[model samples]
Target chain A: MTEFTLRSNLDAMYTVFLARVRILSRYRGWFLMDIILPIFLAAMPILLGRAVAGTSMEGNFLKNVGTANYVAYMVIGANLFMVVSNSLWHFGFWLRNEMQMGTLESLYLAPVNKIIILGGVAMYTTLRSLISFFLAFTLGCFIFRVNPFQGDIGIAFLFLLVGLIPVYGLSFLYGSLVLKLKEAEALINIGQWVIGFLMGIFFPVTVFPRILRFIAEIFPPTWMNNGVRSALLGLNYFLGEWYLDLAVLWAFCIIMPLAGYYVFISIEKSIKKNEGVGKF
Target chain B: MFEDVESFYAMCKKQLIYMARYPINFITSFAIVFIIILMVILATTLFIGKEETNYSFNAIAIYGMILFMFLSDTLWTIGYNIRWEQVQGTLEALYLTPASKFASLISRVTISIVWTGLNCIAAVIFVYYVFGALPFKNLIFSTIVLILTLSGTFGFGFCFAAFTLYLKESANLAANVLQFVFMILCAMFFPFSVLPDSVLKISKLIPLSYGVDLFRSSLMGYPEGFPELLPVNQEFLIILLFGIITPALGYLLYRKAEKKVRTDGSLGMY
Candidate 1:
């Protein structure tokens, strides 16, 4: 057997990443759908606004959301939703697919650390999601006649980059649920929508009831969403300052992945001990 | 005729049993629709304000949403579900059985109507309580429009199943794309007046767009600027034709594709 070293582990991770990327490349239409669906999602609310509020849509939106640029706000929200949704889906579905294919057992027996393999998958998901987010945001802005270059693009990038870690951490937790329940599609579907709703995909969390707003504020995507929108569209951050809200996200960045990984590993070990990974 | 009816009943029972095996699927599907409706309402309220009671807007959105749910469920359960059977290695086995294929295809519609129908009723009730009173005008006509719209949608679903057989792996992506396309083209969540003139022109071209317009407009009691695509009589005529003709045409297309796949020995090649 080959000696397990850092170099070999790095190579294994790269192989896994490359394999996922290659598979995704074959499904070219999914990439296009990723780009198009966010725009469509943002359009639903925008059109509804036009239908209801008519000429005063922007004024009402400004009064409620603190940004007259509802287009950018929604585009940003939808793209960030895509990010969070994709992370949950790719990770959970990856696990479920492995289980179904009877490969999770073999993966467990592999010499490389499971976290390393997961890290590889997480990296691929992040790359795919960010690419889709950028393309969709740009396209949605153009389609809605909103200027894409309006705000602190650098800080917006910082928030997005910082926000992804916790989102993936949430995905790890979701993957653990998939392992335990063995019903990944329904779980991921509900998980994505729940996250989207809590994160205020098309509206400000301030519109939510007090308890709902509090619940929404705890999810990292909410901060990430407000961060990007505030940076781009001049909306106020949750904590009144960009850095303050980002610092909270930083706290999540540290806590969520650790908690998620611990829960995932615990569930994984329990499942392995009881029914084995290949049982699906 | 009796045997075909029995086969459809058995097939529906089998599908329901599979659904029962996954209780979470049923529960989450119910919850997801509510969450989605709430999100849309919250978003709309952001612009219209929470204080304003716009019953017409509520009626339009809710009714449009009901049809959308049926159409979406039909697309997935009836159309894309054949892809599931193909993946599970049961498509070929299913073909080997002596049961009627048309019955098997149509049986899936039972779940869409039953489950999605329940979800729609709950959604209307949920909206009524939360958003205040919604218009329920011309209920008898609205019901007829709904039934006709669903029959036409199921026919479209059959056509999509044929496309799935032809497209194979790409069918999943196609379904996702088509769902959104229909959402926009049909203006399922918004008034047709909000759609650009260009898009409205395209929306007028699709038969389902008429279904969406006439159903909601009649429910809304034909408010000004309602049924934005064509006159009510003309739109209903289109829906009538769509309901009467599309199922036979779609079934013929499905049978043609089914024969080609079986002959090419690719029925199980998912």
Candidate 2:
């Protein structure tokens, strides 16, 4: 395996990124629908809260979830879900689609590292997720009549930036799963929902039992979510301090990508030897 | 007609075999219901009185879920069945059949509805068992409401299926988006009252609105969450009126769309 120059790798990343942008621009309708999805997801729990609690949401929410800004709480959770969900689906499903389209073998023939090409997709996923996240966040606030720019905005941005790395790592992990398993739709669908459930997209981890809470806390997105909510809505952090949660996300950032890359590489070599990666 | 029955039954058997082929798909669908139910139970329990969130309440939640599931499946099968056909390279062959497209659609929709019905029954039983007693207060009336709900959904499904064929390549996205769009606008979980006034007004216009309301009211004896916007009789009248018009409208619209797609020569493009 010859090591490519850094500039060439960067160019490869940019090329893949540009290709994604062009293809996404072509399907203008799907792009718009994807943006609108998180808002609708957020609306479900928000409306359910309205129907259930009536005027008591502020006080009761504070009691249960540690914040009176229940609207923003759910909006943030759902948007984080959008980010995680889109990365997993887009990166993972795109690989599966490429296999079906017979582009996987061509990609393997390319001189640039597969990771660099994947870096391009990961970059594309991040751009798209961030776009959807803010659009839905601001729009949801306006619709729900909450102040969107309250709390520590800078910390929330920092958490989002840090949290995104591990999400990218996990996307590659997901991509590898598709490469090996060859069933993208069901796996991605089920994976996204299970993430949503585990991440406590609608409720705080405080409501989860010991086992569930432990599971959620270990997952970086769960920490990222709590960090954002804690910053934005003044909710309690998982370990009672803002930096403490950020540190955990940082740890995941290192661990998840390395784990994901290792697993992905091992599986890719095996698939190449056996049925080949394009068998899916 | 006898031949039609035979064809339809054959289609039914085919759909059943196709369904059984994908255990993961069925499990995932079943899991979606469970997850949604869990979300409803957890989120509502946090805000409302425990009594309101108890077993009886679950019965109502299950009803809402079943309504959403039925409508979603009905709409999606109609919309997505085409995508499957196109993928498998059978669209051209299917269109080559002498029978009208609606014959095939009817069988598909019928099979889908049966699956959805069974799923709902399973969910209701699960909810009832876990959540305690289900108040089937007005059994005859609830039964009537369920029929009206399914009929309305079925009518909408016809239009959806035809619209999907017209959509060609974009059918899957349309179905996927509309599934949640209906979930939000149609009050599948909360009462229609929880939606903003503008959204509530729109909900009243939706076909699923009346169906969801009817299910909640008749089975759980839950009142309209927002009665000021729409009175009970007015709502029922609108439902009955739509219940009559949708199938006719759907059939006509589907036929018209079918003709247009056929003429445009886009059916085999994808």
Candidate 3:
């Protein structure tokens, strides 16, 4: 007979979150790298553009990308990409780590619902990613000599806040893949890049071909990225209005988590019915 | 010599077989490279506009990317694989064997060359089709430069493997940081002209930077300001010495680290 009270569930979630925080605290270098890598990632293209277009870089960028501030655009893209990537990697790797350590079975056998545990991990991941995003974005702007304070930052933060749910929902789907595939590192490495490409991390989605643009539009991170850039850099929103664009994210908030949960549950059931979750 | 060759062959076979088992890993690695290259290309177009077709710039980026892939592979495959072995608890068992340890270390280079080489070729063809004709010239000279560059890079990989033995778990962070450091300092995705003067001076000091500059500049037919750090002849001389010297120096450092770890009895303690 397992207890399923609200307080107990909340307590269990907090405990999992605290344990992860303590464990991550021991790897301080990883956190530092998370904050630093985005700057370098953004630098490659900024420098490349500088080398190629030289004096006309800003003008050309404005003509094409809808912003003369190429530095801020790239920086925002890179930082947001990192945030989305961290979400996927952390959630997927959490499940994979448990599977590898042979504790996933024990976890499944535990009295608490698996979603509660996942919720805790998602909370921790969200906190870490948002911190990394803000820190890295600010640090990158300073390094590139771009003013970070420009634009409707509050709305950019709003986009990030609304957009995170679908991203985590996508992570749930990714976690299911890790469970089935049992190749976390390779999959996560490739998965992040695929997501980055689809989201147009370094370029506008309009630059993609028609079909590709349609596909990119359906991805929540694409909307999130465009929304952030629109807010911060004054780029036109995908829908030409911020509220409409955010409404799409709002719709994703309802659909994606449910879809992700359904898929995850189905996969979990199939794997358990076959060889069990501990096999990995 | 024959025994060393046999050991190397066996290790290489084992690695290949292991790779073959994971078909997804193979396919995803190929796809990831293409995605990155395309992403960078499209991103560059955002700045230069869609109408511009600077094939010389394309040549610079593509050639630099090829070297970057090789260097990155050398670091991850050759260097980090040692840490992987330790984590798997096989480092000690392998160390106790009578096989030549150098053969075991060098075997990973074959995998890097074969796998990364294929990826680079596919990327070149893909870029050529999508982005128009790239400037391809001085093939024989570029080949020599590439070989020398790879030799020096493999040496750096050996040195990194040694560092892994010393750093243990933290080597992962070190490798990630070092790769980015190399990317920027070597100006792998851009020309030296884009780097600040202070960074360019530091870049000039690193031997690998010369390898990058010379390899791409020669491949792009040494257009005006192609090899930005120094004259072609001077850069080639530097690469020539680097190619010859680094492997010997790296092997010595690795041997020293191996000896120290063995003496400390921490070879298996990862």
Candidate 4:
């Protein structure tokens, strides 16, 4: 009987997931738009290097970064940023969208607990982010003319996989803020830029000031991004060892998700006790 | 004319007073913009060449960033504010008033402008004090440039708000797109010289480039260069044109949209 009940709860959440996928599918142009923007974002740096460095651009990049292929380095950064950004947008700010749609309250009305609904949202976000990630990654690689599967692909994927749980968990904490605030535009807008900055999407965190570097280290996407770059581009890891970096990410995995979940649930309860999640 | 302006001022003041009552809302709104400006300043600083760079006016990038943030937040606030008011059912009460709706809307937007401008001023002081940037000396030119930029900004804001009246659901997307486009195309991070010639030419068509150019010229100490391709004082002319054209177009659009909704009796479609 308990098994049946758990299965039914999962099934109900899946329905919500499917509905979102279907709705997004109806707006197919958005997927293409996402793929295009990252290319342009990456192009600016590549072109700037060429313009500024002139004939010595390749040598300049090779001297600073590991690879002479700055194009590939930038493309990878942009694609990973797409993943990080979409995950946050889908899982974090999507709560605001849900509230505005009045579906947030409807879900809260259900017999299932808040965590279960969050699980459904996280699952949906994960699936969508990865889809966009793969599509943008592959297409961006094609545009930039580089092998997308170069270097320790398995280890890089492992970093991403571990990194995602914490990212989703962080998004839940961000979602809690949206719930309490009842409007998310300012927070989401500010947060994404901060995430992009801390992640060092265009450059390594080593280039940051000492204090900034410390702040960057605590951010999960910074580790995820650095790990991916180190794995793929043969860039130096922060700990001077790939395994050490991976272990730190794992530590973040353990701490952030639990901390995130606790904060989220607490905020959820507070919001419910006050104006509720449907306030938007 | 004075009465129209007075009524609009009164409406704007009332809204500001109401917002002041909710201290958190006002503080958070300003803080968010301030934070965004700080991020932009940081990003722009990263790419600035320490030596052997041709551009003398690197600080103009910071100015562009502040202007971009101010315009984007102010314009975005207009739409979202109206939507929030609509959701709160205060929009109808305001609409039923004897004062003109456009004036009232403009007044509300003016409040956003004042708040966002304060944030920008704070951002400028923070950036200058922290970075020790040289003081801008061309006060009169900078003032004219700011006025023109604001006029152009208000034009775009009015049009965007008019569009929102027809499609309320698109407000968030519109806000995001507007801000993104301004940032990317207007070269808010770096100099416009970084863009390809083709992209640069296209960006010239955007009203934002004038503000960027004027600010860069005044602060960074550039003489009226680019006369052959862009024309001398073209930024002023373009802003002047948009200042006259955009609000009129936006007003017409708003009236048409309002009429359509009234006929259909479905303003609350969202």
Candidate 5:
């Protein structure tokens, strides 16, 4: 392979980034609706808690969950889940959209590498997810009248920042499968709900069975959720220390992205050999 | 009429044969859908476990969700499959045939229904063996309920298919919206009781809920003192009503849309 130039790669990334921002701007209402949807989804549980537990809301919640601030806890989980959900949508479904619109083959014909284009896509998605997360988290706090940035804000951001690497990595793995299968919409639609469940978006992973808990822990989103909750709501960290948990995510950051990229490239090569990317 | 019937059957058989040639397509769709159903079953189990104080999803509740899922998988197939055919340039060729367009369209739906039924059969077998034999106490009643449920789904599918005739590219969007409606209104994963009072009331007005309830009554056994739940027999009445309502509207809309496409000369424009 030839030596890669950083400048050219950055330019390619920026080009892909601009394309995404422009497309997102076209569907402006849908983008805004996503930021609002998670808040409503989280509100149900908070209101239900208040209704069912009445005056003992804090006591009842703290008794089992070890957090008096169930509102903040659920908000963090939901917002983080929104990030996981949207990132997968961005990378996974975007490929399918391109294929459908006859753009995937066009991208394949370009001199620039697929990884550069994917890098740009990932950058755009991360930016959008962070914006949505902040909005939803802030608005949820305002609606529920709870402290949103109470616990270890810096550490929580660190976890989010690291957690995204593996999450996107896994998303690329899913994207490859979508490419091979050609059932992107159905897969993503069902996959999102399954992710929500496994990540314990509305409840703690501690509530899951032992086997389920083990599986959930392996998922990057579950770690992100727990880390955020631990940071914001003062919940117990899985590793019992903030640094240890962050370290695990950091390790995943190194391992998963490489593995995911390998899997995706292998699949793309095999596909190109047989039907070719243009077949879609 | 007899000639049309024969040609429709021929079209259906031809479509089936063409699909069978691509065994991977059918197998993968079946596997992906089965995995999705399995995930829903797990999620439903978790939701029920949180409240029910019992670990088991009664035969009715499980079957109800399974049926809705199966229907949801199939109902939208017509629109999406048509859209794919249109993309492949085969749809225009199909229209150019001597067969009645309505018969050809319905035949496409028949092909999809058969494929979905095969998938459902696989799922049912998986459930029976993996989850153990569900006590389906009223076998004959359950079959009637299943038939009604299938009819109601076909009704919704027809209404959706009409939209595909107008906006070819928007077929995927229509399918997504339909699936969302099934999840929200049908209350497949949770009881209607858990939903907001307003949502619950409106859900009852949708025929899919009655279909779900019918399956629940047959498979899970009717819940104690829950008069609001649609009985198996009552579901038959609702299904009959929807069977008339949706297909009539669907056929009308489809005819109007098809005519407009013909007049505008835009069928192959996309």
Candidate 6:
């Protein structure tokens, strides 16, 4: 095949990105829900803390999690969980949806490199998830009467923005698995809870057992969550300094996407050798 | 009724096999609950320390989670089963069945209730073992409360099933989102008093709120939440009232809604 010019590749990616936006807009409630879901999720744990500690929770919360602002902590966790949750499920489902819609073959037949299309999806996922996270985080803060502006705003944003790269990378890895299995629901649910637990969606990773905590530290979202929480709530970071944590995420940024793309291409080629991408 | 009972049993068997086939879903459903419970435990204990996590509150949280999860599962299954059928291209065939539509709803719920029932028992044992608190003294009494809670939840589920018929593609999202609302409104993880005045007012309107209180009160070794909002006896009376009335009302509303669909010439709906 002839090498495609940069303009054609860019145009392909833009079209795919625009398609996701337009289709998502048609189901208006889904967009609204992405904003609203985290608040109630955060509320359950907040209420539990209030019930458990009563008058002493403020003092105790500060001692344990390094932030007396438990609502903001949990809200931050919940919003990040939404990001992690959506990145995995939506990316996997985007493929399954295309397969079921009879569009997978058309996608494969397109002359441009398929990574351009996946790149388009990655960009869309980033924009949508961050916007959704922002709305939900702000709403959660307002509802709980916490100061959303507390902590280092720029660094927290830095953690979040840097974190999305590896998060998207992992989603690509997950997408390939879905492509192989042709089943996404069970895997999505399993990944969601597992990551939600390990990432401390409602509590700090300090609470996890030794092994689980070690495992959690290896994941990028764990650093992302702790990084953001540490920056915003004056909480403890996994590593000693903020830059050290960012360095780990930067490592993940380098390795995960390249690794994911490699694995995905291998799976795609093997599937093509056997039957095809449209087999599902 | 006899034919419907047979149909219900067959559907239940079908669902049982489906459940058996996807034991991962079966196991993960409760595992997710266990994870949520762990999150709650970790969150609470992080603030209160392990020892001070309050035995009474733990007991209440366990049963509240039981009811919350049961109602949430039922709400999704009964609400989305038809929509699933529609997507599978079997909805029109289901409409042609001589079996009562009520059988379809109840059978779907029976399967979930069984699953939820087993999950609740497992949850209780797990929570009690972990936390060193089980109100075994209230076991028989709690069973009575559990039965009533299931019936009242069924009443609500029946009402939701009617609306689910019209929600079509939106049924899953609508149902799941509402569960998040119900999670707060029903006081599934906390007392009603913790809610602000506006939400507190909204809490009283939810039938599950009464069952949650009754279930917690009977199981927690004390009345849980705002006793003055409604007394245990009064709450039970209202929930019992809902239990009797809602399915009947739901049946009527569903019929009216179904008639409106045909009359409005919307039967061509996908």
Return the top candidate by TM-score: 1
- For B190-219, candidate 5 gives per-residue lDDT tens digits of 556556787788888888787776666655
List the DockQ of the predictions in order: 0.88, 0.59, 0.80, 0.20, 0.10, 0.65
- Report how far residue B267 has shifted in candidate 1, in Å: 0.9
> Where is the poorest 10-residue window by lDDT in model 3 chain B?
B49-58
**Which model, 3 or 5, shows the larger DockQ?**
3
Candidate number achieving the greatest lDDT relative to the actual structure: 3
lDDT of 4 at B23: 58
Error of 6 at A168 (Å): 1.0
TM-score, one value per model: 0.98, 0.92, 0.98, 0.85, 0.79, 0.94
Off by over 4 Å in 4: A1-4, A22-74, A97-106, A138-150, A180-183, A270-280, B1-7, B17-57, B83-93, B223-229
Of 5 and 6, the candidate ahead on TM-score is 6
Model 3 lDDT per residue over A1-280, tens place:
7668999999999998998899789888889989999999999999999988999999998998878998888899999999999998888888887887789999998888889998999999999998888899889988989998889999999999999999989998998898888888889999999899999889998988999999999999999999999998888998889999999999999999889988999999999999999876
Return the lDDT, model 2, position B56. Answer: 43
Candidate 6, A65-122: lDDT as tens digits = 7778887888999999999999997798899889877898889998879899999999
Which portions of model 2 miss their true places by more than 4 Å?
Answer: A1-3, B49-57, B222-237
**Cα shift from native, residue B23, model 4 (Å):** 5.1
**DockQ ranking of the models:** 1, 3, 6, 2, 4, 5
lDDT of 3: 0.90
lDDT of 4 by residue, A127-190 (tens): 8778777887888888668898788999889988888988987887788777777547556656
The digit string of per-residue lDDT tens for model 2 on B102-213 reads 6687777787687778778878777777657787766787777677767777788888878777676577778778888888888777767777888888887786677777
At residue B107, candidate 6 shows an lDDT of 82
| Candidate 5, superposed: residue stretches over 4 Å from native | A1-8, A25-82, A96-105, A131-157, A176-216, A232-234, A266-276, B2-60, B118-133, B227-236
Q: Name the regions of candidate 1 deviating beyond 4 angstroms.
A: B49-51
Model 4 lDDT tens row, B49-153? 444343333365457766776678657766667766667667667667788777876777777777777877777677667656644757788777777777777
Docking class of 2: medium
Pull out the clashing pairs in model 2.
B55-B131
Interface quality of candidate 6 as DockQ:
0.65
Per-residue error at A200 for model 1, in Å? 0.7
Higher-TM-score candidate among 4 and 5? 4
